[model samples]
Target: MVDGGGAIQRTTAQFEGPRERLLCLGPAALRTDELLACIMQSGNGKQSVYEISTKLLQYVGGVYALADIDVAELLSVPGIGRAKALQIAAAVELGRRIVHKPSDQRLQIRTADDAATYVMDRMRYLKKEHFVTLLLDTKHRLIGEDTSSIGSLDASIVHPREVFRFAIRRSASAILCVHNHPSGDPSPSSEDIAVTRRLEEAGRVLGIEVLDHIVIGDGRYVSLRAAGYMDN
Candidate 1:
């Protein structure tokens, strides 16, 4: 790599690939297409990296659509093959891990609001009801969080077994049951209270305490324990 004066213009000697732009100007400087090109490396040789990446984006609609796509769908792009499709899928998964990875400090859920705060960032805007459980240690520190079921329009549809499987396996001392209402109403339905009571009884048998059942809505929540439903 040399310059017009026969001197070493090593940094700028050759073409400006996505990697080089990223190095010189940082990630924020790169456009969406440039970032995709970086992941894609180079084209199938018939087209440039930018062109192929743009075409791929067009085929998939957008980067947002990439989240739900699998290997086979990634291969639908004209110039994309197994290697390219796999690289994209792997990158998406890696990004997802980064986004959802918990904080270094162990999460503690003392109240329903605390538990809601821990999950609201991810669960807030969901299009369907998601029943989730937070497994807690003896100290009430969060050990794990799991989605027990999705599209649960009614609480009765969410069985106690599905909610407690991991808590039993992990030997969790207590658990918090939380679910989002897509309708954005945090008010607890009669069925919600019934399910919570049922789960509390089931937990009593298993030696796991059902601490609270929190129903999430649009920036609001209701705690069954707080409402005197769980005290009985």
Candidate 2:
């Protein structure tokens, strides 16, 4: 039983065993709860925040589920007081923002696969469909990314005007539409094709070229343009 003081008192023989050392190896390799406990460095007389974070992860299902959780839901977990909940929320948000932010100043989307690789790590785990637009300059460098819609498993409501609105505002020369299928199938549905066609035609008139439409699935993705849908 570790107390709320940064002190590991009363080490059981079981804990001192080689198996335990192998499991609780280093701070860098600790599980989410252990890492959180390291940050917290203490418990609240009963259990450590590490233990609480472990319980919270279990209650929420896992780390991915926890990412989808809101502040209220996170706060409801034991030992994850308001401050800790906010901290977790903030950390997740920071990670999200980092992923969305363009990394390389010279990053350019040369192909559908390139675009997919950029957003895959962020969108693949989403529980719901999210329609995002990547705005690009004439050189194909990413200027911005916008979430046009979010919806249930079947569909996400989006408007061509909404998609281009950000492009126009940012003076982007082209755009690539990307979305995630929580069902883990990257195949484009009839509705997906229709939406892409609509956006393409709209972009034609607006002088903002529709570069491609990429559908993200579980560890896989499909580019409508690369599949010959856009050219046809």
Candidate 3:
């Protein structure tokens, strides 16, 4: 896979009675999958619309990865037909248009604060944890950002190989790990510190620097490096 095969896998909270809740509680109550379910409208004979949406998300990896998949690739999934796949591809393109405007030509990550501010809005609002990487070029300019995982923070979930594989492919000189706290606290847990140390060591071996591990919370953030965990 030319995509480097490292997945992003970011998802919103799973929907519980999505369409029903959508009527009673409004769109804010719908998960990302449920919102997509609304777009898909219905599924193939076997799977329910929600199940189809979930399977499509898994096949493409996630919202971030969806932008990379063409309609042909989407048709490979069991429930996604040609028309449905194109519908999804078009929706993904529309979303990519909205949230991922082109980066400024002079984009830079000069400080951990700069890194946190770059991703905080997206991270903070997420209902689950999202482990993301800011891929930076030699001049510390932003090349791309990859979400490595989305869920609770832990070492097992944060695979160094998967994390660095894409960074290496991006020709990134350094990476900044950013993840959110759904509980609204920006403080680092012991697990957070451990993952930072582990990934920092892994980055050293791979010849790519791990600049900082930032924890995003409601309107605030933490830089492990500034807290004496790692250095810039």
**Highest TM-score scorer:** 2
lDDT of 2 by residue, 1-232 (tens): 5679876655656454333544556545456665555444456679855577678778887777655677998878877777777777887888788766755575799988889999898888887799999999999998888999988866888889889999999999999999999888999998998999999999999999999999999899999998878954
- The digit string of per-residue lDDT tens for model 3 on 1-232 reads 1245785432344235576567656898688789778878887888998999888778766765564466887889878888888788888778756785766585789988888877765666565677888898888988988888866433226788878989988899988889888777999998889889889889888899988888988899988988998755
Model 1 regions lying over 4 Å from their true place: 1-17, 43-85, 99-105, 125-129, 151-157, 181-194, 215-232
Which 10-residue span in candidate 3 carries the lowest summed lDDT?
7-16
Clashing residue pairs in candidate 1 (N, C-alpha, C atoms within 3 angstroms): none
Please say which candidate is ahead in TM-score: 2 or 3. 2
Clashes of 2: 0
Q: For candidate 3, give the lDDT.
A: 0.79
Q: Rate the local accuracy (lDDT) of all candidates.
A: 0.83, 0.82, 0.79
TM-score attained by model 1: 0.67
Model 3 stretches astray by more than 4 angstroms = 1-96, 104-106, 152-156
Q: Which candidate comes out best when scored by lDDT?
A: 1
- Tens digit of per-residue lDDT, candidate 1, span 20-136: 888767899898899989988988879988998898888876776676477997887888989989889999889878887888988888877898887676665555678899999
